[model samples]
Target: MYDFLIIGQGVAGSLLAWELAKAGKSVFVIDKGNPYSTSNVASGIVNPITGKRFVKSWLMDEIQPFSLKCYREIEHDLNVNFLSELSVYHVLNSVQEINDWSAKAATFHYEKYLSTSEIHYLDKEKVRNPNGCFEINGALKISASNFLSAIKNWLEAKYCYSEEVFEEAALNESRDFVEYKNVRAEKAIFATGYDEFFLKKHSNVKFSPVKGEGLVVEISDFFSENIVQGNVMISPTMAKGIYYVGSTYEWNFRDELPTESRKSELIERLKDTINCNFKVLEHVAGIRPASADRRPILGFFPNSRIGIFNGMGTKGFSLSPYFAKHFCDSLVAGKALLPEVDLKRFF
Candidate 1:
């Protein structure tokens, strides 16, 4: 019998499995192999400062360091280069914005992350930055696709991974363990991203699914070492001259398919950000399992063997590692989860 049976091999499940294995727990991971799953299509940008207001991300102090440590350790273990440390430059359109950033930079908390020097324009021939920009250090552009693929290979070699859809009907729960398709585990945790169909039976977690679209484009004569965020964000990829540009957040969407409208919108925004010529290489879309409260959904069902760890949303890259460690400790050492992230609030 395995110590844990985890459903879904997205970011959440993959990280949780790694943590559990480190704790000397036997784990079995089931992945449906959905190509369009959020993790598969995620740009994997971990920004300490986010949104238009330039507010620091939640738990940035703790999450940023822990996430970097986790990814670096995994990179060493897997012998893969999936994590790229990059600086994020946010456009300062007006004098007031620049002054606001300057004021914030003087503060002890924001000093380290915010750049004190002003950058008028990244590339005068490419990007249009009128009033200059402020920098956020310790940003990361993680290649989630490559990382997951590496994890899958490792798990397969250990005979702990399967690529199959999980059916609730196949799950058998006993007093001490849960069994699925002849595989028994002491407990089961669902980290199934936006596929929360089974959540209805376990808890009253409500998900506000947000469909996000992004584009891969080839830009000519555009060279940058840092991520540029103006009207849109342009992040460097592994391929030369190719950048990942996106993304549009839409709450009302019929399906997860990429829309021509969003593509056009993104291109227009890209054009507004850059003056260089570009060609669209690909357009992708996925649904984010954002919670109603905009925090992660974690913890177990009352008096049951089932548990959940989902709803990292757009901040998945920044949030997953820290919480995965937290949840793992809670599971293995009887430690209590943080009250803010505990699902009891929703209950």
Candidate 2:
């Protein structure tokens, strides 16, 4: 019998599997091959600076280093370049905004990341911006597809992955073990994304889903080496001549299908930022499994023979590695968990 059986192959599942397997624990992953899952479409932009005030990221100091070490080690093991060190230019929208950024740069601990030099990539003549741009440090762009692909290959090499959908009927749970199909494991973990239809079974934990929509635009004239941010962000993808521009956060609607109104909204915003001819390559949408509080939902089920490691939310790429290790240590070595992120948040 294996040590654990994991449901879903998104970032949460992938990272937990990596941590458990690397620790010599037997693990298996089951997924439905849903390309539209949130993990695949995520721009994987892990920024240490965000929002209107330009404050430091939530727990920036510890999370970034852990992510760097983990992704680098995984890169070596998988022989893939998935992480790129990149700076984001927080395009100040107005003179007042620029002044606010300048003041924040003076006292803000992350001042080293902010820059006043004019960006060379942007067209100075066409864009309608009187105020200059300021750059910030502490941003890393991760390619979700690349990272997930590497994890899948590693798991498949051990014969621990299946592309079939997971049915609740297939799961047999006891006080200490879970049986599924031909495999029996001492424990089971659920790491599914916004598809938390099974979460009702463990009603103690609370998860709020947020719908996010992004657009892919192909432009010949607009060229930038750094992530551009103002109302929306334009992050570079590995695909040539293409960039992922997004996103809109909607709390009311949580559907995977792209809406025409959302698409139009994104296109109009894109036109306001870049003065260039471009084509709308694709429109993608997904629901994020954001918790009521910002921290992740990491703990065991309340009444049954199962566990869950989920709720990475918008910070999935940055938070997954650190917490995956934490959860695995708690399981394998009887380690204590931080009170803030512990599953007891709901209680």
Best TM-score among the predictions, by candidate number: 1
> Candidate 2: worst 10 consecutive residues by lDDT?
119-128
Per-model clash counts, in order, read 0, 2
TM-scores, one per candidate: 0.97, 0.94
Q: What is the C-alpha RMSD of each candidate to the true structure, in Å?
A: 1.3, 2.0
Q: For residue 173, what is the lDDT in candidate 2?
A: 89
lDDT of 1 by residue, 1-347 (tens): 99999998999899999999999899999999887789988889899888766788999999999999999999999898899998998888877777777777777888768856555457667788877678889899988788889889889999998899888899999998999998999999999988746656644787787999999999999977679999999999878898899789999889889999999999999999999999999999988888888899888877889888998988888899999999999999999988889977777
- How far does residue 159 in candidate 2 sit from its true spot (Å)? 0.4
Predicted model with the maximum lDDT: 1
Error of 1 at 131 (Å): 1.5
Clashing pairs in 1: none
Q: Write the per-residue lDDT of candidate 2 for residues 1-347, one digit (tens) a residue.
A: 89999998988899999999889899988888788789998889888877777778877778888888888899998899888888787666777777777677776466556644443234555343446467777688888889888888888999999889898898998877899998799988888877657767656677777888999889876666678885678888877778999998888884678899999999888777777788999899988888878788887756755877888888888889899999999989999888777887776
For each candidate, what is the lDDT?
Answer: 0.88, 0.82
